[model samples]
Target: MKKAVLILSIICMIFIFVQSWFLSLGGSYFDFATMFQGGIVGKILALLFIAGGIAIMFKPQVAMVVYFLGGAAGVLASMFIEYQDLFLWGIVALVLGLMSYLFNREEKEGKPGSNL
Candidate 1:
């Protein structure tokens, strides 16, 4: 479960970052802009998700909340933006966050001295 979350999180971060880069003024790929389309809002949210993804390696539960929130923000951001896999990745992020949350909870509870 952790591995799955880690891989997906990395993919999400990279996709967001790369897409953002390709859309920036310095970039020239007009076709790529439609892939994610969130403007500055998307970029900021992407940074948040990136930070959450990195933090998850050390702290699963807390980072997962951040991850989930980032996903939700993406979904909300979609109201104004367009495309971006038709918001498919946002839902994926939500599911990934939920899975990690539940998995970490179970792992913590199953431990010898866990109180959960």
Candidate 2:
């Protein structure tokens, strides 16, 4: 389960880049400006998602908080940008949150460095 969520997180980040490329080429069905404005907050949130996914590998507990925060930001972004249906964005957040919740388990050793 942990591995699965890690994979999904990677996929989501890739999709974000792909979607940006699609908009650049004017090949997407949705409006780019409304969703991909490259605003300060959006970029920060994007970075947060990437960072959260990376951190998940080393520390699942801390990663869960990052994932939850990222999911919340995504949902908020959906509300501000209505180019695509909010339901889809909500689903993405829901999946991230669910996966994080399902896969999180305490490491046997303290903080991965105490003892065997």
Candidate 3:
């Protein structure tokens, strides 16, 4: 489960980075102005996702917080930019964040052997 979450985080971050890059390059599928203007926020969000993914590797607890915050930001940014795809990424980030929190909690509680 931890591995799955980690992989998902990495993949999502990569997608976000690529999307940000595309937007920065003036590539648009629907609304160009929205994407271009939102690209700055998108770049920041991408960095957060990348940081969260890296943190997940060394510190699951910290990564949990990062993911949660990043997810919330992603959702809000998506709404502001009127981009639907970012909402999905936000959902994924939230789920993975919750999973990481649960796993960390379990480890702290000493309920299991702790794979994370």
Computed on alpha carbons, the lDDT of every model, listed in order, comes to: 0.67, 0.58, 0.75
Q: What TM-score number comes out for model 1? A: 0.73
Clashes of 2: 0
Q: List ranges where model 2 is wrong by over 4 Å.
A: 24-46, 83-90, 106-116
Error of 1 at 68 (Å): 1.5
User: Candidates sorted by TM-score, descending order?
Assistant: 3, 1, 2
Q: Write the per-residue lDDT of candidate 2 for residues 9-89, one digit (tens) a residue.
A: 677766655554444345234545664443333445446556667776777666677767766766676677632433343
Q: Between candidates 2 and 3, which one is better according to TM-score?
A: 3
Give the winner by TM-score: 1 or 2: 1
| Candidate rank order under lDDT | 3, 1, 2
> Model 3 clash tally?
0
Candidate that scores best on TM-score: 3
- Deviation from native of the Cα of residue 110 in model 1, angstroms: 1.8
Model 3 stretches with alpha carbons more than 4 Å out: 27-32, 111-116
Pairs clashing within candidate 3: none
TM-score of 3: 0.78
